[model samples]
Target: MTGAIGKPTPYIDAVQKVTGQAMYADDYKFPNMVYVSCLRSTESHAKIKSLELKKAEASPGVVAIVTGKDIPVPFGVLSISRDETAMAIEKVRYQGEIVAAVAAETIEAAEAGVKLINVEYEPLTEFFTPQDSLKTCTPDEQIHAHTKDHKNIHKTAELRFNEPEKELETAKHKQTGNFKFAGVTHGFTEPHSAVAMWNGDETLTIISATQVPHYLQKNLSKVLGLPLHKIQVKKPVLGGGFGGKSDPFPHEMIVSFLSKKIKRPVKCTFSREEVFITHHGRHPTEINMSLSCDDGGKITALDADIIIDGGAYGSFGVVTSYYNGVLLQGPYLIDKFGFRTRRTYTNKHQCGAMRGHG
Candidate 1:
């Protein structure tokens, strides 16, 4: 009944969406566009020992093949952590890390080429989820040796707002709850896909199904080792994103690297199974809440203790841990707030930002 920021208006593309006239990234077609297949690492934790590309390179209609070594740069969605890669060259932390990619004249040929790539794996003891990781964690054992902390904890933090301890002393009412949300996929029927072309003049153009084009442009530039200007990322009308397509995807970069190597257009569209395996989704959070209120029902304090199962890598978990506290501070008036969130790394599929990410 009071002030709302802006009156809701009809979506401009409502017609296109309703009538099935929407042209998503997968809908675009180009002459001589080559299909690409990305080979994902199935080992939850293993070192890539070797690869044999002779058969794949010689396959019929196969233009070229690219692997982690083809693109040396390692990058991530956050500027703070640039540890990820288009393909995992040394060790794969997750089951779906891209190990190799193939580009060919036809989709079938590309898929066949992927099979031809020989990837040798050296097995490592696996940890399934955060609980498992913490239980078996040792000073010598490392899920990510790159982390500043010695343990498998990807990131951890404790933050407080105003003064919570004093306010709770006189509060009349107190309540608390334990909440848990399982990992949920964005489930945008149209799966993640991208078409990348290497322009003859030292530039690459990418048409991807993504939410943050500006971010993708920057991250892709980091991974490709190309200047930001050389890479142009265009996001066509999306069937759905729901925060799934916000980050710079490894598959998208795989296509770009393959396109660069082949000097032709390469397109990689994720299969439904691949979509679940390769892409990052919501993190399962276990939250404990506490609240303090006065006799008149005036709220005095709020506190949240959250543990996020940050599968494998630090996606938005770096910030989600903080957001879980910040985002819940308002909506109900509280004088003081206190929060402590810890995000731990696991061996499952990595958790990135998703709709209702917290």
Candidate 2:
């Protein structure tokens, strides 16, 4: 069983996964387990006015009700942008952002609790595209406070070598084009699911369908205020992440927090439609690309300016912003190259890594 670098090799766990013998996160069961349901915001962008949980707390079979205030700390895959909480805090930047969660004896009870919870919101201006973000607005209108001068821009990545503009002007042959790409979501086979339990010794365990268990472990420690040794993140047989499950999800944090508070196992699973709402797929982009060549058709210079929409939270947007320009450095030889990529915040599902990042 020897193979060269380019030769095909069998995946180590292909047999177990294909034969339906693999244990997925949802397959795990614990005694006295409770089901959790999350209440999501319906507004694209809004400030949270007030939340009423009296009805939800009194709902039949509802054991515990949690809100953003319970787990207020933010966590993201990238350290540069940790701006997502287990639930919406003072505001919700996207329509589907979770605002509340309930754990109950049965799934039906959890659903009932979800319907009982009431939320009041004051709608704010929404930025649906990169073009909208380029326009300056008041500080209160900006999606995030970090953006300077009331801008919605999340990141601006630039790289330059030599003088591409000067070379492009001297080149005899040149080609330029405009490109626009709509955002896309990963259509993984199985929806996201997780089961969390609190160990008797004040430790927590999370079994989830995730692509990066180590990342989740580190984030759980940060969000839960617990030591790394006190938390364990296990990735079970995954149906296919396609980079969608790479980030530590809010649902995972919600389940873990609820279980610890109630001293019982808590499980949260997403429906197919809900999975679409939790997208972190390809970024929607507007690009201007120019390539210059000599009379002999030899490559001279290349330049590009790209504007990408990074909705709601910055999942893997910082890396995505760099990859949009940096990945263009290739096997071909070129004397001059330049690129500028601006990733802006939009009021929608966030965009992150996918099959082809660039």
Candidate 3:
């Protein structure tokens, strides 16, 4: 391959990454800075009847306590779907869904504070898989208010470029195959961490471990009810990100909200298990390929039916649907083609776009 536009460049931060001293979100510290830990729900589905934070606020060394009520704005990565919040409003739709958060003088104090905040729940039936969703369709099937679901299904689609039915009927050789793909976790040793500080005079500064600084900044503004210019979000050196660190997470919102409430800096660091439970991995998918070949070497028809297991929330599930169906538009071409795909919500850790997405 000849030199591409703006010839291939070397790794921009290769040296810094290789060296052990590159500063990340957790490396920086300031005076009176407090650590925050989320009090997440243990159930996969439920209605949050009550959230009591008095004990957390009164805990030893506790500086402040935060819950969904502290931050009212609904924010999300995609501007179109601002359905997420700093904490679950009246319900916990997933197992790791945040119900409240606490900030304290010490890291251990923060963890203790979170445990003090009690979260009450009224259990609801869970949707564990996409197949179960298809079998049961209803207007009230979705777990969330702002989701595109015909029953538990999140998104459904059908696209055709040619008459696959007619071509397949006249084809000579035909074969059908079914396959499923698993998911992946980022395993970025740095842990999902964030730091937020109120820059006095109605402004906020958020130092986040995120790939999309601009998006996170916008989300913080919406979550904190601050103007765009009033808040600044910076992306420090990242240990790693294969899409997991790209989206605006609840911890991100929690820290920002807590900072605004206490008028001080706040930070949240998720444990390894918390990381997997809070966010998402790859889209678990099923593919049905119907391919037919003509008498000669020419291709006749190819049809694909795909379904994606989009866990809990609609976290990048829409785009995953495209990748699941469109990626087949590849290495080979056929005379006729048809593609149909659907993504349904399952009460499991969300299925997001990961490395090599499709």
Candidate 4:
């Protein structure tokens, strides 16, 4: 109690929230605003054989229809791995990937339009786990073509100091462990939502419930081919991010593109199921850990090998590939230490930052 900086302080915005006076992204209203709904892919891994949108374009009250071809540029939170398109262009790496989007006068019309769009997919060999990805495969079979040696391995991070394996052999006590972890998602009450408006001067304004507005703005510029100055991103009262809303999502780009094309404000809000598909959460991992202790109970060495599941795209998997092993080096002292982490691309929701990042 003596070290407590202040006595039980209240959140500054708690009063407004309790009074129901706070504004979330979905709370905004505008004249002639349109609603958007996406047609997601049903296959885990597949090539787009064909996409027919005539029915959707002629759907009742439908105003705009956009697909991957409309916005081909890729965007992600990290620059090196911006591998996500606004919608599935050539292929979809995971189930529930957005393939097309519709904008209409009413939410019902948008939903109806989404169902009218027709798509044909050629199913490909899918890898669902890190073990499945590590196996040798044909170049065309790999999830990402750029990966070397025809493997699904996205990243492999290793660090070594003072030969931990040799040191552990000479220790008085040594313990080894194999741990498995399941994936987790942020289940916030308020779903993800965004509203995009194209100003008269060819500028764009986006209001979203996000934690990283600046990052979103930068990514929007990349995919939309608009200059940084032409796009303005605003973050509303976030119900909670927990790092889930930190990434620049495909839906954000989808809504903005439709708004500019139709010259009207477009709004998109996800259902709970859609939220799960856009997951950027902790990586599911299997870790092999070893620790050594001397006769005097002093720590001697530590070594770990981790294999993490990085579904679909590389969100924060690059950093996570290192963090799973590197973080163990801190807050403790060991004479010898080493670790290796291998991240594999899988056919599921891509993982990114989350609470603890474990």
Candidate 3 deviant stretches above 4 angstroms: 1-19, 137-141, 146-150
Q: Over the stretch 1-358, how does candidate 2's per-residue lDDT look in tens digits?
A: 5566788887999899889889988888888999998999999999999999999999899999999999999999998999888999999999999999999999899999999988999999999988999899998899999987688999999999998998888778999999999888899998999999999999999999999999999999999999999998888889888999999999999999998999999999999989999999999988898999887888889999999999988999999998998777677887799999999999998888888876
Which candidate number would show the highest TM-score if scored against the true structure? 4
Candidate 3 backbone overlaps, count: 0
Estimate the Cα RMSD of every predicted model relative to the unseen true structure: 3.3, 1.7, 2.9, 1.8
At residue 234, what lDDT does model 1 achieve?
A: 91
TM-score of each: 0.89, 0.96, 0.91, 0.97
Candidate-wise lDDT, in order: 0.81, 0.92, 0.79, 0.92
lDDT of 4 by residue, 27-90 (tens): 9989999999999999999999999999999999999998899999989989988888889888
The TM-score of candidate 1 is 0.89
**What alpha-carbon RMSD in Å does predicted model 3 have with respect to the real structure?**
2.9
The residue-by-residue lDDT of candidate 3 on 154-262, one tens digit each, is 7777778779877777777888899898766777777788898887687888888888899888887777777899988888888788888878888888888777777
Off by over 4 Å in 4: 1-8
lDDT score of residue 214 within candidate 3: 90
lDDT preference between candidates 2 and 3, better one: 2
Candidate 1 colliding pairs = none
